[model samples]
Target: MPYNIPSGSQSNSSGVALARSQNWAFNPPSIDVISSLHILQAQPAAVTLSVSIRDMLASSLATTHSDFNLGITLVQDADALDLFALSSSTHTISNPILLDAAVLLSMQLEVAFVDPTILLEGRYSGYIRFSITATNNSTSIVEEVDLREYSLNLERTGSTTNLLTPRTVNMAYIQGGVSPVLDFDIIPAAASSGSLGYVLSHQGDTVVTLAGTSTSNPPFTLITGDGAVSGTLALDTTIWDSKSLGIHDTVINAIFPDWNVILGMDVNVAVFNAPGAIVAPDVLEFSTLVPDNPQEKFIDIFSTNGFTITAPPWILLSQSSGVDSARIGVMPIDVSNFIQGTYQGMVVITASGNIYEVEVIYQVNDQLETTIDLMDVNFTKDNLYLQVNGYDFNHFLQVESTIKTYDIAGTEFVTTDVVRVPFFNSSARYDVGEFIHESMRWIKDPQAAALGVLDPLSAPARGLYQKLGFVDFNLKVIDRRNQTVRFIRNLNGTKWAPGRSPFNDSNGYHFQNFNDAVARITTEGFGIINIFSKEASSLVLFKNNVEIDSFVLNGGDLPSSRLLIYGGNYLPGDIIKAQINYGTPAIPQLLEKFFVVYPKTDYSCHFLFRTSYNTLEILQCTGKILGFVEYSRQSNTVLKNGVDIINHIQTNRVDPLKVNTGFIPEDQRYMLDVFKRSLAVWLVVPQYTQPIPVSIESTELSHSDNDRFLHAYDCEFKINRDIDEQIYLF
Candidate 1:
């Protein structure tokens, strides 16, 4: 009241009354600025002032204060507010008294979140004080200073001591006695002073060893912490040897204050054992042997521990018994003097202090009790026909012969042992051993297994006969009856001879003026017809210019010399007519033709057949033809045929005959080579019908004496035919 001043500040009675209030007089007017600020660790804290001078003072005083101003000061560490610098430390308060006489002054001061200098973890203190000042013209300042205290409470909700993600520690493939390293990796989330601890838990192939074992001492030096957690796990593999041959699954847990991570470990150990056993075969039995030339048999012996051999002279050991495998061969010592009886012996195989016994048993036979006979032997001036006695035998009859079948155009020659032949026993039939030359013929029907009383003409029997490469055969019967040897040879000539002809023969008939001869042939109930060559051959039949049926000739090597014309069924005086063709001189034609005929047929008819016919004529002279031409791929045609049309024909032909030939006897091979040198010394007959020259094809070692004498060998001869000339020569 220092002189009731006539001023705007004193005009409001409420302002005067507020100044008189004892509570306002005793304490500085201030508002609660902020409570304890809870914040995340490593984050800043902030406060915005809600208290104003107008709210701190009475409303009349706030409205009366025209020049009121607010002053704000942050009292704390200088670096406290560095994280968020306050935009301004002091600000002017806007007075409403100047505009409205009843309004109170209300304003705000903004303060940003500030980070503490020390990175305070718990609670940090700071203060913001606001002061009011007035120009004394109208606005009144009730309080000089207002203090708002705040505290920042930093709580560690997240941790800095973080453990890296855990992974598997694999102790890769290990051997029973080997030690390998267990490898893994780890990294700290950030720089930390804390250490990581690992605990290993596993069983079997994997184990933890201790430094020492005692009643008072621990078995292992426990690995509490390695200071470092990222490195290779170097471990001893010998630990796996304790329990080998399986998988060891283990876990390694990394321990830390904040987290625990488990790492997996798998250890696989393999088994390795030492070697030591003796192995041997069972009993060895030698069934039968021909005393003249006995064969040897072998029994095998093996051992893990090396040893030596102890055997008789008759039992030959391939090698001295040792760690490796060896063979024991058994053969009769005095085979030449062995009588026809059963023989027994023993063979001892020893290894690793172990002995094995192998028994040897055999039976020797001096001669075979079998027989063969040539029953129907017919000899014509041009060819000879022979029938083998159909009597069956218990054993095979070793056959060694050459066969030759004749026609007008070509000839065929067959040698023994060139193909697998079949043998017939009382019960069943079996193909002869690959290189064995044996013959058999079942007196009973071959198809009897299917068809009772099987016909000899049955297709099955005929097929089997042809299948064994034996349409017909001239075979030698040695050791057939009481071992009485019989010699058989196939001859291709005008008469039966002891040896084979060097060349095949052909029919002697020259065809010319066929068109003129057709008229005369018609008067003789025969008419000539022009033939055309086709891929396959067949004939059409007609009676009195009326179309009848057509028939195909059975394929495969038909003889050019003989032609058979027939219908499925016919009656006497049916007066059948037919036509056929061979080939013209076309570029791609396969074979040439000859014009000839037998008695009742027109001789001028064209006759054609492949040059590689199984039975074809190779030589011809005067009124006779010699067939029985056999071509062998092993015959060395280059040396025999001298690269002519015969070589070309044989080269183009497929060899259906597959035979396993043993090594030629050394002595016989040398003799054959010597004889081959003197070409004139050879007896090669001249071929008159085949226009192209023929030459010796082969001089092969003969198997005729295989059973009787091992060293005794004979030489067989063969020749190639000039089938290209068969076309015009006939």
Candidate 2:
């Protein structure tokens, strides 16, 4: 074969090369745009007197759609002939073409004038250009790619004398004699035979050749049968049960030795050990998905040849020896010898003289466990109760409130400040004062007490140490891994219930002076009683000693009540309890909410606070002329003042109200400690006659002054708001 390449080695470089074996007669020559110029150099070129175009199909690339597209697209036109009407394989053109002697004069002088190939190709179907470059003395020929390389007939993969390759299964995973029969497309159905060659070592095999193909080229000694027959040729793989494996190759040769054609096929066969004794599942994952479990699991083994089972000492097998088949129970035996940690072990079963290992493993230790146990977190009565198991966590409280600060001139500006306690473990049933976040927890500082905000000493850390406005309280609970979270939010969009524990104490809403206020059931999914209760007395209301009202609620009924303490519905020291039967118990759980009636205040002391039990404290003494006391706050951390100034600030100025405190010879001093430890405080004149706030005066009551009050201690109050004219807000 010869390739007339004008110049440059690239396929696009002017050239036309043909392979002797290529027989493509009508397909589009891939024009490779360089459709495989590689073939041109593969075999040395020899100029022959004549060579058929069919030979070019062997190495040149070509493509054809299922339609009538030949070497080149033939578009429909009035002058264009239908290409499909002509026979492709054997038909000859009706008109013969003749080239003028002048055409030869322009053609290469190097090509022999008498060449037969030039005479055979008797047509000029299209324009052609050919030239010789003087620089390299190379002939540059340009012909239509369609007519020259592709018009040759395409013989996709085989020939008449050449056998069409058989479909062989390569790298075929066969278990026993079960495999596909070789379907050879025999060229001539008779007088053909083959030799099967193999290589047990080849990971994957498809290549078939005449030489050293026996070990990689490992002989298929046990497989008996001719390579392929007329159509359905199956090899006798029955005896292939031995661990012999690899690719099997069949080289086809005519029954007569004289037929020298080297045609062949290769079927990749990965032979697996035939079924003898076997376990259905290769591996079993037992136990409770837990590393260590006491549960036992069973596996069945089957074998025509009786099987024997063996495993490590710790792996106990119910039946070690069986006839043809048996079900065996397995479990770990002596785990008691192992410490309180994970111990891993594996097991294998030897069935029918074959080592079939069903690798199973189990490791137990302190490394694993369960998921988040946060069913819900709620404030029952006073304590914030959470349903969590075996987890050590702390609560997070994010609070936003109006922080009031005054400049040296006493010009106060209110701003929002967010306070956080990530590890809040506040409790009301118990004292967790030590666990309270320091920055926001109350300390006995006179600045806070002197600023008309009394002590919250009864409980240190309430809402924000001693701060108020105290509106927003957003919080969460995070465990050690930081992977778990449980949070509660604003109950009514205005008040946070989980943050308030005041129900247990005589504390309720600040009321802002509503003659009567409605306490609606706020938390969603939580109700004092099932609104669906049909019983006569589902919700009962108590006033002091007698039952004042009862409500039988049905569906659509609002689970709420209006407490009228101010419109003479109740009296001072009156405890009105609203109880509801709730929960899953047959008798029902009694959940209670209450309201304590305090006499309409002339001057009142309101403490904005929170504990597991109390949210706020409003204390007014019954002693005549004495309301809550008040004192002036200084910016200094330590304030030095005369006992006279502390005990009695002159009324000539803004006299601290001297209300007589009917006392407790020792233990009852207006709960002064609670007055000192309040989270926030506001002294208001209920009349709104004066908007300016006042402070409880005289810091006389102390831990040591318990016995100092004889019969009573006159309480003094001061207007913390130094402004003369009354102002409303702090």
Candidate 3:
């Protein structure tokens, strides 16, 4: 057994060497294994699968996943055909598996990485890599698997921290018989750090640029991590293109009608920004600049927006400077004493390049005039006379003389004589006896006598003489030198008979002659001589004692010695006595002499006599006797006794001699009585009503009647009512 078989045919030996070489190529061992085997025994060549379980498991999992796929194929280089049947078993498995059995079933598997995981941190940089493989089951065929490299970058984007997945190849695979190399850069999305940095920095229409780099072209994209990019950036400068430092919507209104000097006007100015920008230094300046030497200057400024300045201190005015607006005020000047024309001035307003001016005009007026009215006229003296009032006497005098005279006797006489007798044997001298005899002849005519007459030297005497119907004549006097006589003619003419002249005639020698003779005898004739002489003394005694019977014939009381007697003398022994008869039928009879007296014995004589004489016969008889004796007395005694007799006769006489009666007729006496009654009624009537006040007015009617009505408005008050009470008016 151990012996080698003799070498057979040389051709068979060559075939054995070819077979051994083929076996050695298929199963080549290490040198130790070959030495060990040579020392022991010879072996046959073996074929096995060389697939890693992890790789195979990965390949098997990749082949079943949808996100990634794996494919395997076996292709023999000699046949050039894929063996799908040999790879079908491994492909049918759902999970990973190892490659162990082989009957020339070469594995051809495809692997792919599916659903790859990505991770990121705060602001970090890193890389991620995944592996895939492909296997080939065939005779002498090779396969490869590839994984594409992905790079991820993490950054801050918003308030949240996130691992943003970067964009990469979504679908990639490594198949059998292909390159197993994949290269890709990973870009991690910007992560929000939950801080302010993540907020968007752009506002409005601004653009924000985030800085980043990527191996992939166009790597960076802006992401609004959070919705809170709200803050405004810089203000839109376009909106402020027409900006101005001015005012808008201005309004002006007045508070009063007229302006005054001391008080200033108030105004409000409202200013605001143009909707966006804020105003800086919001205060406004309001000032009026007047020239230093301004001539009648005045100004006024006002505003509508709120911008004001401090009021001037010296001016006495009230203002609202505390408001936020602009305003101005004007003061009135006392220009009354200035020029009388219109004055011009200016008001300059200085407010932030805004200027305004106004003109002021002042008018001057003249002073007012005043006047007074007078009510009374002045005079020189208190007492005024119609004749001698005002300037001079001659101015008001209308007559020749201021004094007036009137005749006393001849002009005032009212009697007329029938005839007159011659006086003292002269034709020019006439006796009144003829006139009296004629007057007695014509008893129906009244008798009166003229006592005396007066004459005036200047002016006419006709007015005086005509008042009494007397003729005025100038007569020449014989005895009295340088004496002019004014004679008033008697009523009757002279007449005489033969041997019996009108003068010194017995018929003319009447009781008046006897009176003259007796008065001379008693006062100064023999009666006085007897009282002083002795021879004449007996005659005086005889005459005084002798009582003549005829002397006592008349009945009544004896006459007083003061009475004139006719043709009688006083004797030294003459006695007179008065007896009173006072009783029933009282009779006054002669009794005895009351006293003894002598004529011309003394200058005094008793002329008054009182008696209780009754009986009309005795009174009449005594009056006759006394009348005869009264005419025989001297002119002086006649005058004295005549006045007493006339007074006594006037008192005692029953019938008075009728003189010239007044012109009032007896028929008109009733009318006069009625007028007097009406006057009495007016005086006694009681007034009950108020009197109407009378107003007088005088005006010049015409030139003709001007002088006639010179003294006008001469009014007098008639008492019509009792106006004594005080009246009050409301």
> Top TM-score: which candidate number?
1
Q: Could you tell me which 10 consecutive residues in candidate 3 have the lowest summed lDDT?
A: 614-623
TM-score of each: 0.21, 0.19, 0.11
Which 10 consecutive residues of model 1 have the lowest summed lDDT? 4-13
Write one digit per residue (lDDT tens) for candidate 2, span 7-30: 110011111111112222212211
Question: What clash count goes with each model?
Answer: 34, 50, 49
After TM-score superposition, the amount by which residue 154's alpha carbon in candidate 1 deviates from its true location, in angstroms, is 99
Per-residue lDDT of model 3, residues 556-603, tens digit only: 111111111211344454443222221134653222213334454222
Residue 620, candidate 1: how far off, in angstroms?
A: 31
Q: What lDDT tens digits, residue by residue, belong to model 1 across residues 285-342?
A: 4433244323455654433345566666655555655443334555555555667777
What does candidate 2 score on TM?
A: 0.19
Task: Mark the regions of model 3 whose C-alpha exceeds 4 Å error after superposition.
Answer: 1-301, 304-338, 346-359, 364-730
